[model samples]
Target: MQANSASGMAVHDDCKLKFLELKAKRNFRFIVFKIDEKIQQVAIEKLGDPNETYDDFTASLPADECRYAVYDFDFTTEENCQKSKIFFVAWSPDTARVRSKMLYASSKDRFKRELDGIQIELQATDPSEMSMDIIKARAI
Candidate 1:
């Protein structure tokens, strides 16, 4: 993962790839929220396997200024490549602030402490602080 200080944005390419791999494996139900031009929040529940391709996932969403998203994992079926018992919600940076905040707040309540603590810490800290914190947290 990379964090660009000049832009005040964090990049999690590896994490994103891992997430996509997991999603493809078990077709998880996910919610994506746009945080900004270079930031997104994802949440998942009962993730099974990943079956949807990147193109397929992106195409399903409404075209907007959304550059980042989050989602939950659900169940996957090998026969049809169609996710069963799936539920997803998405938002973009251009989405209304009130709407986005409401969604985030609600999701946070629903997903309280479900995400890894390191991810939560990274979200709460600045870029410079993230690396050290992540390293320290991981060591423990």
Candidate 2:
């Protein structure tokens, strides 16, 4: 019985390794956007001195399978250096069907505008709500 259990464990490990190898060989790719310092400055400048705090800006959008937006912000401060916050936004597709799609600039707007592009067939979509963790994982 002990030998049989050991063999089962080895088989499981081998299956996992084979699955990983097949995943690596696939043509899976994710879109990457770099939030440069200049873009961060622009977004903050546009936001201005609003009464709302960072929490207010982080609220999820209330929409169906319509246009959706996501904001990612990072704050950093160093000794004797000015504190700064960076922001990025991504928009979802306009179709009634919920699915993940590539985002592109909708216009020359400085508000980090986003528009839907081609849809990724294998990507999952959350109609219940937009989740940062899920989006980041899928993007990766």
Candidate 3:
């Protein structure tokens, strides 16, 4: 899998981390996990195949204060036609119904922006440090 870097360099199997800025002042982030051999062996013995689906891995995750959503997105470019990077966005499930709605609204807003030709930049970054213009320019 080829990764698209802000510097225009290609990285293979790069782990993606994502963060979202919520209006409620709570921070949310997700990290793409790489399940190694040891974990796989253990899972095969105790649980089913962890590699089967993200849901399998999610089931193993210890319950936390937050809920979660695990999914991957395929990213491809003309220069990297031979491969596509699967970026995982593991969103924590919010217990508060209002906050849950807010999260959905934020995602909807992002999609709308993309449809309008606006850049969708959910970087693994401090919201204060993120520059929408810079992220938008990187797409070009």
Candidate 4:
């Protein structure tokens, strides 16, 4: 694990590898990450399948926890062209503990900086904030 000295948080190598596989090879529909404060490291928590729906991606996120996720979103343009975009999400639900929220917040940049090729970024404290309607609106 390589740590970001500024944040005193380490990002596991698998996080980057998984991100690359998703970004370059489209191996996953989305990827979820969590921070272990005791270990001061960011690690992969789950990987969504390429065929999974957007609802599946959102369902994987806990209702009362903080997480960082990357999603590969596919959509059709008004002109009927198929397109895909990568999204980086910072999930800090309102029901989560303050300590957990703060830790995830402070360490976000360090972890996000490791995943490249992200075209959009969304930070949400509630499910509605990252709803599919909002996602599609932004994607379009």
Candidate 5:
């Protein structure tokens, strides 16, 4: 993981590894990430089971904190064919501190760059902004 001189934060090595597992191996349905302010590094906060619902994944995030996440959304296409798309989510809730939001905003690009094969990206400042409807719309 390379450190960003601007934010002084680096993504933990495991972030990319877990993402790869999700991408190539279907190991997890979703992953949540947080920046460890004390260590100044991004760390894996949680991993969702393969069968976890979107609600469960959303519940894992704190109501007043910022986070980064990747979700593997599986759905049937118009032809009834099964398909999956990987979504990279930047979750900076409105209630979170400005500094926290700023840190996440600054570090997001570098963090995302490390994970290869991401298909979609979402940036949300509220739960409604990242709802299932939005996910589905983006996947299409």
Candidate 6:
């Protein structure tokens, strides 16, 4: 029965339920909602956009497995709704225990550049196209 906090306002359970339903209807799912500040910092630093800051992100993991993940980053505020930048990652299968080698980069352009010559198990704007293929996915 914990209340959700947004902009210091106490949002009740009913509102939370409705929000979840709406997200589902939109084909959106959260992979890791609250990324650690350090991770965010490192990602931005490595991505070469040091000044950009994102409060949170929503990802489409699609299948129960974390084979391929696509994320959209944004800063949520009442004054602005800046969004639509995407980050994608390909995770190593659990049997390999190589999740630590997960590779992530932003935008399809960068995704192509960074992951070039590296075989991708899946690639599409639609998450429904992702699969469980894990071969040749040398994690960065």
Off by over 4 Å in 2: 1-49, 63-76, 91-96, 99-140
User: In candidate 3, what are the lDDT values of residues 44-123, reduced to their tens digit?
Assistant: 11222223443443444333312222222223456765422222222233433454334433443222221222223333
Better of 2 and 5 by TM-score: 5
lDDT of 5 by residue, 21-136 (tens): 99999999999999998889999999999989999998998899999999999999899999999999999999999999998999998888889988999999888989999999
Candidate 5, clashing residue pairs?
Answer: none
Please provide TM-scores, in order, for all candidate models, with all chains considered together. Answer: 0.27, 0.27, 0.21, 0.97, 0.96, 0.22
- What's model 1's overall lDDT? 0.36
Better of 4 and 6 by TM-score: 4
Candidate 1 wrong stretches, greater than 4 Å: 1-49, 63-90, 105-112, 116-140
For model 4, residues 28-83, the per-residue Cα lDDT tens digits are 99999989889999999999999999899999999999999999999999999999
lDDT per prediction? 0.36, 0.27, 0.28, 0.92, 0.93, 0.29
Q: Which residue pairs collide in model 4, if any?
A: none
Candidate 4 CA-lDDT value: 0.92
lDDT of 2 by residue, 49-117 (tens): 224443353333223222222232223334544422222234343553332232223221322222123
Candidate that scores best on lDDT: 5
State the weakest 10-residue window (summed lDDT) of model 4: 108-117
State how far residue 25 of model 4 sits from its true place (Å).
0.8
Better of 2 and 6 by TM-score: 2
Q: What number of backbone clashes does candidate 6 have, counting pairs of residues 3 or more apart or in separate chains? A: 0
- Residue 85's lDDT within candidate 6 is 30
Best-first order by lDDT:
5, 4, 1, 6, 3, 2
- For candidate 4, the per-residue lDDT at 6 reads 81
Q: Alpha-carbon error at 83 in model 4, in Å?
A: 0.7
